[model samples]
Target: MKIIPAQEFEMKRESDYGTPEQNAAVKEIIQAVRREGDAALLRYTEQHDKIKLIAGSLRVQESELQAAYDQVEPSFVNAIRAAAERIRSYHQRQKRNSWMDLQPDGSILGQIIRPLQRVGVYVPGGKAAYPSSVLMNVIPAQVAGVPEIVMVTPPATGGTEGINPYILVAAAEAGVTEMYRVGGAQAIAALAYGTDSIAPVDKICGPGNIYVALAKREVYGAVNIDSIAGPSEIVVLADDTAEPSYVAADLLSQAEHDEMASAVLVTPSRQLAEAVAVEVERQLELLPRRDIARASIDSYGAAVVTASLDEAISIVNRLAPEHLEIMTQDPMEIMGSIENAGAIFLGPYSSEPVGDYFAGPNHIIPTNGTARFSSPVDLDDFIKKSSMIYYSKEALLRDGETIMELARREGFEGHARAIAIRLEQEQASQTGGNDHEL
Candidate 1:
């Protein structure tokens, strides 16, 4: 990791991470799958994943899930169940209610909150299986009262075998209604446009490689999406009081995610910055995915030494990192001043991994500086709201003139006429006249 003055470091744009060629390839895959459906999915699976899919084996059955439970360790299953409980408990508080209020004028306006009928969760399953991702994606939708939740993952070894047992067990524990052994852009297409075997979903949520992200983007208008997520990132704003070792470990947690992942440290202490930099180098040698982490640090990682704590905080808010860690003397005091960040981890004990796995907060957060506008995936993502309006004759008369005048000002003559005719009819009726069609 390189240490530089905060003002000297240039902010990197998200486009610097991936090339146009990569995007174009993802687009081609998405378009092919959209046009060809399951056949295209099978071909991609065979070519990319080296797995052959038989017709009936695409969707996992109850029997297969039971067998997965049998295969996985009992402690792992319990851990998944415990994580699901925590996630469900936390999201239950975010549930919204449909409400309405009656007025003296008899006009009624309200919103109806309803869960999505069905949702498809895409879990990446090739090199690593993300059981925690399964819990994060499914539990919130379940808490939102979604009736059907379908999960899709790349088959373990092509389509000949099933998805990872831990993924299956997590899905079952999270209350998923169905599971499909498909992956990549093809799986996204299958979920967006229903195949003979797979059902279309109202929304799709999860993280994946660049191809998967692009596939979700292509299918966005056809179906709802949580967000166009980019590579993972973390920013730690610390002071001299922070432990250098803890800061180094926390930064490396996100760095190992991918070569595009960014891990940044901002501090007022030059000595602390130097200490953290050394710790990062020493710890980098011990990580299992050191090559990926090294590349990420070389390209995107940095230690920014700010002149003051306020300056460090300014840099943090400007970046608006997906994950923000405050490791100062009083993290809570600084937390109130932070305006941007998908998730805020306070104190050394509250590391990024706590939120990623066992913590009640959802790990599927905005990435690539999108925390400036986007938010973490929550129950609201799996629900919709419908506005309701009603008006009685009295209410129409009470506001008729104002409504007609506004409509006329807007050049909506038909709207003006509609209200005008109704008011005129009411007036005529009051006078015992037969001009009902006024």
Candidate 2:
């Protein structure tokens, strides 16, 4: 890992997001799936994932979901159950009811919140099993009262025959029975535009590899999409009082996610920065995914020494990291000044992994600098709202002239005339068909 001064620090976008050529290839895949449907989906699945599948095998069978429980240990089941309840409890609070406000003129205006009839969740597979991904994506949709929650994950991870049992068990625990064995951009295509086996969904959400992320971007308008996620990133803002070992471990947690994943430490104390630099080196030697973490740390990781803790926090906002940890004399004091971050872990004990797994909040967070404008996946992602309006005759009559005047000013004569005609008719009725001024 490099220890660059804060004055010389530069943030670089990771290249793993894919080049133009990769994006073109993904576009071709989405178009092919749209044109060829199941045939193209099967072909791409075989070509990319090295898994040959017939149309009948595209969807996971009910029997397979039942059998997945037998393959996993009891401890795993209990853990998922606990995570599910906590996640559900957290999201249920976000559930909103239809509301209305009655006006003085007997007019009523309201918002009708309706859960999407169907939704698709994409869980990344290939590198490792993300059973937590299943819970994070599906539970919110379920809480939104969505009737059909379809999940898509890559099949044959590392050339294995079946999907990961942990993922299946998590899905089962979350009550997600409708799942697909297909993954990659092709799976996104199937979700965006229906195939013979899989029906199209109203919206798609989840994190995936670059191909999947680009595919989601391609199919966004065809079906609603969550934000285009980039590689994982974490920025730790610590002071001299922070423990170097805990800071080192937190930085490495995001780095191990992928070679493109970035882990940065920002501190005011040169002593703490030097200490964390050493600890990160020591910890990396023991990490199981040392190769990947090393690549990330070599290119993207940094230990920036700012002039002050306030300066470190300012730099963190500029970066708008996906995960931010504030380990200082008072983490809350630093937290109050933070303007941008997807998730914030305060103090020493609140590690990044806590929110990733057991903690109630969704781990599907905004990545890259998207935290500057976007948000983590939550209950709102799964629902749509229809504005409700009830206008009494008196209400429209009182506001009719104002509406016409504004419409006329906007050069919408047709709109103005529409209101004028109604007003004229009302006047004619009131005056025994003699309201000529109207």
**Best candidate (score: lDDT):** 2
- Residues 1-438, candidate 2, lDDT per residue (tens digit)? 788899999877663557999899999999999899999988998898888888788888888877888888999999999988888998898888999999999999999999999999897786688898889989999999999999888887524757887888898889887999989999999999998999999999888888998899889898999888788899999998999999999999999998889999999899988999999999999999999999999988999999988789889999999999999999988889999999999999999999998889888888778889988888889989999999999999999989999998999998988888888888889878855453
- Least well predicted 10-residue stretch by lDDT in candidate 1: 10-19
- Stretches of candidate 1 off by over 4 Å are 16-28, 157-161, 436-438
- Residues forming the 10-long window of minimal summed lDDT in candidate 2: 156-165
lDDT of 1 by residue, 1-438 (tens): 899998798755464324688778777777787677778878888888888887667888889888988889999988887877788888999988999989888778899999999999999965567899989999999889999999999887223556788888888888886888888878888888888788799999998776788878878899998877777899999999999999999999999988878999999999999999999999999999999999989999999999999999989898999999999999999999999899999999999999999879899998777888989999989999999999989889888999988998999989988998888888988898857563
For model 1 the TM-score comes to 0.95
> What C-alpha RMSD separates each model from the true structure?
1.9, 1.5
Which pairs clash inside model 1?
51-158, 51-159
Compared with the true structure, all predictions reach lDDT values of: 0.87, 0.89
TM-score of each: 0.95, 0.97
